[model samples]
Target: MDAVLTNFANGDILAITWRPLLAGLAQTMLLSLLVIPLGAIAGLLIAALFVVSAGLARVLLMVWIDFFRAFPPLVLLIYLYFGAPLLGYEISAYAAIAVSFTLNTSSYFAEIFRAGIEGVPRGQWHAARATGMSWLQSFFVIVLPQGTRAVLPDLLSNIITITQLTALASVVSVPELLHTAQLAQATSYNVTPIIAAAVIYLALLWPLVRLMSHLDARRYSTKLSAAATQRRRRQETADE
Candidate 1:
């Protein structure tokens, strides 16, 4: 066992794969940090507009969201990478992923956020307004918090999906984690790098999935309790 462990820890597996993997890991992290926040913020703004807008404006927003949401991020990345230079605009692979992720995930974020906002009780809005708060004030103060909490599990799922999509950057030669792992495996003629990368990906993502499940469970429990309380109150009132 010690010998097997020693072999796994040293030589080509450790030395050759680690540097490239680290580089890939950095790029993956950088892309994630950039895309997640921007996508979330853009989605928030669009969702707000969806709530406030009516008629033509709402239709336009829906069209935009659907158009982007329906697009595969890989296709969008391909188009941006290969199609841009034709338009006399040069773009790097990293730039392509950034743009694609931002646009595609924004649509998802917008939809999820709107769902969250709508899930909040309408009474909350009236309560805020009763205190002489403006529409915007009520949204930022009361609605946003509850809405965000309501949609957090969905948002976390999206983030996890987006994090994995970073692997798609490899198609454009972006040298992300998967890309480096592929290169390492090809050079060493060993499956170790491939296995290592798989492990790394799992290590990074499993905790997120577990957390999302926990939050979803908690949210469901809260709703169940609230419903039970409401039913109990109604029963007591009827008896009275």
Candidate 2:
């Protein structure tokens, strides 16, 4: 027990490693902030285009989504960081990670958004158009909101996934939380820093997980209530 505590729960090691771990945590947060928004915006644009696109353009969009979805993010990151220099282009670690994660995650976000958008009733689009609204306006003002709300749980879950994927940035020596923890572990000759990093990750991500769960439960309840209301209406109509 003593040896275990000394190796994995040493207060001295925590004191020594806290600063670097914090710095790493900050970097991870920054990376998440950058990539998450970039991916989301890019994905929104892509999905919008996919909706409005036709023929070759739609085909190309599908190809783009499929290619990125199939491609491994780590391989993409490594290639961007290392292969860019080989092709006579210098890319920093941050830039590489930013580009790779955006490309990879945007594909996923695009699919999610596309599914959400398509799930909206077609009549809603026609009704919006009948009210003298342009397609873009209808999509942005009416259909998009409903569609997004319908898929809020999935969107939040995807965001959580993207946040976790930020740890992969460490592979390129970007000094994210896990990498910093590894460095600290090496220096302190203890597992405490790694354990601390795990705790930090849990603390950060647990809220998102909870939020997603809440959204899912609420959505399910809404559906059940709507179903019950429909059944009651049918029963009342039959009585009438």
RMSD of each candidate? 3.7, 2.3
Worst 10 residues of 2 by lDDT: 181-190
Can you give the lDDT of residue 224 in candidate 2?
A: 89
Worst 10 residues of 1 by lDDT: 3-12
Error of 1 at 220 (Å): 1.5
Number of the top-ranking candidate, with lDDT as the measure: 2
Q: What alpha-carbon RMSD in Å does predicted model 1 have with respect to the real structure?
A: 3.7
Instruction: Report residue 178 deviation for candidate 2 (angstroms).
Output: 0.8
Task: List model 1 lDDT by residue over 16-109, tens digit each.
Answer: 6887888888888888898999899999999999999999999999999999999899999999999999999999877788889999999999
Error of 2 at 11 (Å): 0.8
Where does model 2 exceed 4 Å of error? 231-240
